[model samples]
Structure formats: structure tokens, C-alpha cells
Target: MRFLPILLSAAILAAPASAALKDEAGITEGLIVVGIAYEISRVCPDIDARRLRGLSYLLSLKSAARQMGYSPAEIEAFIDDKAEKRKLEAVARDRLAGMGAVRGDVAGHCAVGRTEVARDTNIGRLLAPR
Candidate 1:
């Protein structure tokens, strides 16, 4: 909740001027991944410790790619590379498993809340590639 707002604000403020040059859908997916990661980190830290860390790494890669002025096509090519895709998929799988194992309604709460925050802020769309 508190963290979500802060994260969204930071993401918006820290975006590079060339952010618009990256793929919109790709960025959106990355943002969603980051949100889910954050939620898992906070709500189910004991589930899969590496899941959040891995997602943070992926977000960094995207941020770096944008800062380096990579076009949307180039960014997508890098992210979609077999090796990179595998890493992403692995992290996603781990996160999903964690969500399933979490106790009580924490997982549901985190998912719904984070998703609403992401959608309301439109952080991904704001950085849509040109």
C-alpha cells in the first residue's frame, strides 16, 4: 500500500527521457512483474526469497536498456532472447509457487492491491515506446 505509491512515484520520476523509445507492452509486463515481486517480497518473504530479487534484476535490465537509448525493437529482442526469457520465466514460476503457498488471504490481498495500484497509476503506459 504505502510502498506501492512510493514505488510508482519513483518509477515515474526515475524513468529516462528515452523511456518512450522502449516497447510499451514489454515495459508494462516488466512493471507488472516488478509489482508482483514487490508484493511477494512483502507478503510472503519466506516463500521464495530469490523471486523478488530476480524480478528486481530484470527491472534493472530494462531500466538500463532504456537509459542506453535502445529502441523498442532492440529492447524486446534482448528481453526475448532465449536465455533472458528462461530467467524471467523461472522467476515468474517461483513467484507463482510462492503465491500459492502463502497463508491466509495475504496473497489475494497483495495481488489485488498491487494490480489496482499499477493500473491506476498507468506507470507502464506512461513510458510507452515511441
Candidate 2:
């Protein structure tokens, strides 16, 4: 949906810069997680993101990647890579769609967010009632 592309673009901007990170699975996964939480929070009026937790999680992801020997430049370059950005965006979009959140469907997104929060899913943990 239109909303989804905006979310994906936001996620891409927030993602690492540069070409691509070297085999950093956590970084990729973490970005997707952030993107998912971000989308749910974006479309759900009654919900809010665990902003501090999300930021902390993002920082930790970067830190972990650093520990794993990926330089800041490498991580940045990875995300800056158009193909990599598209790949991550596609994954995030698919994940949301899989959960029944579609473009222009506010109710669907809210329902999914509520369900996730109620179920205490990882995405749920990153969201809460406003």
C-alpha cells in the first residue's frame, strides 16, 4: 500500500548506510524488526512504539555487529546499497502483509497490532497502548 512504501522508505533511511554489511545477520534481522514495529505503530492510532526500547535495540544491533568485526562503514554501505535496501524493504513489507496489514487498510493494521500486543510477540513487545 501507499502507507507501506512510506514506512519502508523510513526504514531504509534508518537502516545502515553504504554498500552492505558483511554477513551480519543480526543487523539485517534487527532492521526488519524495527521496520515492523515502526509500521504497526505508524498505522495504529491507539498504539505507541516502545521508542526507547526500539532505539536501544537498534544501538545494540550496531554494537553487536561491531563486535562481530563489521566496521561502521561496512554496515552503512550495506544499507546504502540499493539492492540491499530493496531486499530489506521487501522482507518487511512481506512480513507485514503476512500478518494481514495491507496498504490503505487502517483497521487491518490496527487489528494486527492489537493481536501482536495481546499475544506478547516480539513485535508486540515493541508496542503498547497509547
Candidate 3:
């Protein structure tokens, strides 16, 4: 009987983890992180260089996101949506940079820190695998 309580608690905890993501929108944060990692790879062919830059960029973005009024959930959704739409990344990047090559639509709205995070991550080390 004592174990019943423990089992119930475990089930409750696990339920949220298992069901946290019911759709693509639910997992956007992860997508953003992954996309940043990919961008890092593209920028730096060397692992060591990418690792430091990627970590710094991620740290800055996370801090900025917290300061910005976006819940972690919203950031994730935005990242996922952008990653899924290939053109969105390019458009968003230009918009954020203010180069205006693309319309000030996607990037304009992106938090500057978030855009920097994507642009700054270096993935050469990430691709090499420890």
C-alpha cells in the first residue's frame, strides 16, 4: 500500500514529460536550440571554435529571452516554426540584421538576442562528436 503513493507520483510526473509535446508547436524550443547548433556548424568548420561561440551565443539568447516577455514555450514555437520553414530563417536573419535584403517581417519581430544566438553558434566541434 505504501508503494501505491510512490507509483502514483511517478506516473503523474512522467505523464507530463511524455505528453508535453502534442504537436510541432509544443517542441519549438528544442527546435530553436537544434537550429542554432546547425548554424554554428555551418559557420565554423573547426569544432573548438564552434563550441565556444555556440555556448556563448546560447547563454546570451537564453538570458535575453528570459528578459523579453516570451515564455520559454513561445520561444520554442517560434524556433520550430522558423526551422520548419527554411525560407523563414534567411528572411528572419536579414530582417533582424536590418540589412533589409528580405522584408522586415520575420526577423524584425525576432528578439535581437535570439537572432544573434542563431548567427553566432559554431558547430564544427558539434559535428565532430566527442
Candidates ranked by lDDT: 2, 1, 3
For candidate 2, write residues 18-110 as lDDT tens digits.
543635667788777777887888887988888777777766776776787777666545655666656776788788888899766788878
Q: Which parts of model 2 have CA positions greater than 4 angstroms off?
A: 1-22
Off by over 4 Å in 3: 1-49, 82-85, 92-130
Per-model TM values vs. the true structure: 0.35, 0.78, 0.32
Pairs with steric clashes in candidate 1: none
Clashes per candidate, residues 3 or more apart or on different chains: 0, 9, 8
Over the stretch 1-130, how does candidate 3's per-residue lDDT look in tens digits? 0101221122112211212232333233332343434433333333212344444554555445556555555544433432233533443343334532123333332233343444553222223322
CA error at residue 54 for candidate 1, angstroms: 3.1
| lDDT of the structure predicted as candidate 1 | 0.45
Model 3 earns a TM-score of 0.32
Tell how far residue 100 is off in model 2, in angstroms. 0.9
Report how far off residue 121 is in candidate 1 (Å): 25
The CA lDDT of each predicted structure is 0.45, 0.70, 0.35
> Which ranking of candidates, highest TM-score first?
2, 1, 3
Q: Which ten residues in a row have the lowest lDDT in candidate 2?
A: 1-10
Instruction: Report the lDDT tens digits of candidate 1 across residue range 1-130.
Output: 2113334333333322332333455554664465454444455433322343444545575676667676645655544344444544455445544545233456563454344345643222222111
Clashes of 2: 9
Q: Which parts of model 1 have CA positions greater than 4 angstroms off?
A: 2-23, 67-104, 107-130
Better of 1 and 3 by TM-score: 1
RMSD of 3: 14.5
